[model samples]
Target: MPMQQRMEMWFQAWNSLMQDMERQGARVWPLIIDPPALLDEIEAREKSLGISFPPTIRKILQEGSRQVQINWSLPSRALDPFSLSGDLGWSLDAFEWPYFGVDEECEDDKRYLSFHVGGNGDMLLIDLSTDAEDPPVYSWGHETGEFLLLGKSFTEFVERVTELGCIGAESWNYEALACEDGLDVEGQVAQEWKEWLQAFRTLTLDEAVQDFEKLVVFAKMHGAEDERIQAAFAQYDWEQVLHVWVKHIEQETTSSNLLPWCQLIVKTVGKKAESWVLSLWESEHCERLGSSLRAYVTAVCLPEEEGLQRVIAEMDEVVARKECLLGYAANSHLHHFRAREVILWMEPHVAYPIEGWDDLFAVSRPQWLDLIRWLDGNEAQRQIALSAWGKMLANGESPAGEADWQEIHRLLDVAYEKAILRKEKERVDRIRSALETTMY
Candidate 1:
């Protein structure tokens, strides 16, 4: 059979199975397939990317972008029941052949077309360098920078995924049975709000302002006292809303959840809110609230050189006080800012070792390694660094792989030399003892 015909058959079977499951009270969210991309859009994307997508890929794009949630516990040919639940679907632009360039440090063979990113940052990639009509599917681990072959072709990959039931597990409602009322009031309300907000995307500026007022009224009916919402409703004052959110942020007792709403307001108002968010850095609030504000500003507002300096200063204070610094450093926004400056600021503090290094390492190994290397000098820093490293190694916090092991030993060697230069016999002996057990 033709590959496209086979794909259509598989999709039909998959959709039928999902419908059957839903009818059987499986609480499944049906797959969302986006409209097909235009040929001109595809051509433009190909021109820009400088690579022609394979026939199988083009067929999949023609079929439209698909997002579905699968209930793994239910019968399925495509997924492991034990695998973590999450959404799986190609984005609309994935079909439009958006740029999927390899990272600078990645090997030449690592060049692949990324489509869906798993909830855990694992990527579904098509190996472009393989020169196949339909490139083999591979899973790229963000943490390890490793690829695991999944299937020989896109058709086979879809079949395997459907069999494993992996694509859309997160959309399933496990606790849905418990909500016996047959209606999720909160969810419905939130959904309605989201729909209204989405409508603003297509509305004229005047219409958006009118709808914005209606949204505020609706929010008020729900007992929401957010000043930003109120400010928007009254006179469409976005600057006032920004000011109010900044004030709320500076309050020590403010809930962290409010940060997102503040960001939403800033985003709705556009670049005007950017300056307002940045101005909050100098607010006379407690260090915790100030830090939180800085984090929100850096993450949501906009990237600025001044914002990077503020983050570094915040880290310096955080480190000096032996406070939790990982949250700020690990933020996705900080990566967009001065990543190198952030890493440099974080290096000296690795000796103290904040509480969330393991989580941080999973997100950014390169930055983690840089901090690990900073432990190479100074007797006090070496002692703290070695102790932390030894503990993590002993507890199996570090992955037991050859690459990781070699890196660990390299750092250990540096620490050992530092211990010797400091003439700290006890520390050197301790390091030697740890090394004895660690080295193969």
Candidate 2:
């Protein structure tokens, strides 16, 4: 027979065997397969991965390679049982190659006599309705012939697919289904919420926020709160307000997600927040938790005459304790780093003083000097130059020109010299001497 015909006959026979086991109510797969054909498939796959097959696996596959089985939500073909109880799913299993993108080329190849034993022992041929259309309903439901059952019995899998099918068949506009799915649901609901939120044909903003909040609570349980979720629900989507609020609370960052809390803090706090000296801090954007804290301070304690000062004081204290220093030599680069929370709070005037001296520690001096020239090498750079000269004078050194501060003149030279552990202290002293000379 041709390859195609042979594969079809194999599947037909495999499907028949599975149906027999289901009718018998044998929850455990007890079928077997012809060993040689299965071995051929395994050997071909082994050749593709260029690895030696374990002797034991070779023996098992050889002994019962021709078995066909139908068990509760597990598949068996000959001796090869793809189950948690089996060696295949274990960490040390020999069959765990091609994490993904393996069978793309040989999808049509009859690699094994796959089986579909549902959770409730509902066995049958492959779920054909799932593939009756061009793009399978379970788009990833079935691949080649490996039954993609997410550990669900037949009854449960069928119910899920049926519901998903109703949504899919209707372009996912199923409000009734969404509301039902939301009932008693727990955990990070991003995936489900994303699907259902879009699927709902009609839902008010208030309703959506409430649903989103539930989703947020679920995510909190799972530790899935991240920047992506915060940004997604940052906007005023009435359909997702509650979820956005949950994210805001979870994130605790004040300046980050400009959501209900962002506006809420500004609104509730009134002029206090409007005039409040904004404070800043950096924390992981776990759903804008920091932003929410900022809002809380502004909302709860603004316009109390000392409220703004108090808030700024508290913020500054937190930052200070964190050892954030506002040094001309070190902090000037903060301007270019957008995520440095402090930079968001600093007014433009705060940067004016050290704007010109940033080049001293720049990654590339050529670029810095080029920019300096573009800025007319004016009073700002002149001040930097004079400062460096003063530092050299203070250190009792002469201004030897740009080459004198060789570290800033060429990026690679300093990096190479700095990596030498023996020269570290000497390099540091030389740099200090150079700075003192330049300043004086």
Every candidate's CA RMSD: 19.8, 18.9
Best by TM-score: 1
For all candidates in order, the CA lDDT equals: 0.50, 0.34
Model 2, position 73: C-alpha lDDT score:
23
| Model 2 regions more than 4 Å off | 1-288, 291-316, 319-415, 421-440
Model 1 scores worst on lDDT over the 10 consecutive residues at 169-178
lDDT of 2 by residue, 1-440 (tens): 33334434544544453453344222334433433335667677567646544443344344434333322221221111111111001111223322223546543222221132223222222122323211111111222322332212222322343223211211122222333222112334324643442222222333433555543432322222334434434544533443343345455543323334444333322343333324333333322334335534443434433443443455465466865334342333222221223222332212235433332323212233432232233433433333433343454654322442353444323333444444433443555565554652
Residue 37 of candidate 2: its Cα lDDT?
A: 34
Q: By lDDT, who's the top model here?
A: 1
For residues 1-440, write the lDDT of model 1, one tens digit per residue: 76557757766756765664454323466566555667777767677667788776766666543333333232221111122233456653553322334545546343787777655556667778878887786665655665566667776666655543334212221122113322232465434533432232232333434575455333312223446444545556767655554554455253544544454444445456766655556454334344554565565455566667766676667667977555435443355453445545445554333434323332332334543554555554455444444445555443223334466557667666555545344544565576577644
The per-residue C-alpha lDDT of model 2 at residue 235 equals 46
How far off is residue 105 in model 1, in Å? 3.8
